[model samples]
Target: MKPLLLLDVDGVLNPMGRPTIDYRRYRCTIGTEVYTVHLNPRHGRRLLDLALSTGSELVWATTWEHHANEWIAPRIGLPALPVITMGPGRPRSEHGEMFKTPHVAAYAGRRPFVWFDDQVWAEDEEYLRVSQGLRDFLLVHVDPRHGLTREHLGMAHEWLTLTGFSQGP
Candidate 1:
């Protein structure tokens, strides 16, 4: 079986911290007071497209939640993916905090995998550090200007090869 690859949409795939003329809800807070939120620069859609083409089972681990599929995916010309929605409040690690690594690892049958996200540090990095094979698992950071740059994708391709996810690099 091919190893799993994790992907991040923000700085890795979609560029945030920029400007957005259009407005769309990116998050929701079902707490004492209900609220809908929008990210500063929403570009997750484009990143979604790039990720899907790779033939990996995609998961949305961002704060966007349902909005990623409801709004962002359509706008960016990408299809809906398995979204890993966060709860109202949850304790997170110092790095790779949001990543549900154990779940992901289980989902992938404990096989090798890769992750691409600008926000992941704790779970993702730690998994890479402790996993059986170092080169089999990879984490790619996408550049904003170039949708999914070749460098990052190429790096993933190499890592995938190392893990037997692909026969050739």
Candidate 2:
């Protein structure tokens, strides 16, 4: 089976800190809430290409959860993907790691995986490395201001290739 590619929407796709005027902003209504998100169409294509090249299965690992499919997916040209159930309430971390770290690792189990999020911390890395003993995983920290750039994709591609996880053409 291909490795899992865990994706976070807010900082990875929607880019947080950029000025609103700089991006192609869209107002989307999910349920009764109207939300504004910034997205670059090129990012959509790049992420899809990356997933194809790596033979990875994309899964939403964001707080957006199912709403990602409702509001974010089509805007960015991604198909509906499986969402990681974080369960009710926040994930509790025993080692001061990011709340999502343990949940993500548990979901990945023994499979190789790459996680894209802005909230990744050194503690999360340590938790994955020392506690989980996972060597075939990558925790890529995307800048909230810029979101997923070509450089981030390049890094992910390089990691996938070097670790023998890539099915690149």
TM-score of each: 0.59, 0.92
1-169 in candidate 1: lDDT tens per residue? 5455555455544555442444344443334544444332334543443345444555665566666676556654556777655556664544443445544454555556666666445456576456522434565645443334546666776666554565322
Give the CA lDDT, 0 to 100, for residue 30 in model 2: 74
Model 2 residue 47 lDDT? 84
Clashes of each: 14, 0
Give the Cα error of residue 72 in candidate 2, in Å. Answer: 0.8
Clashes of 1: 14
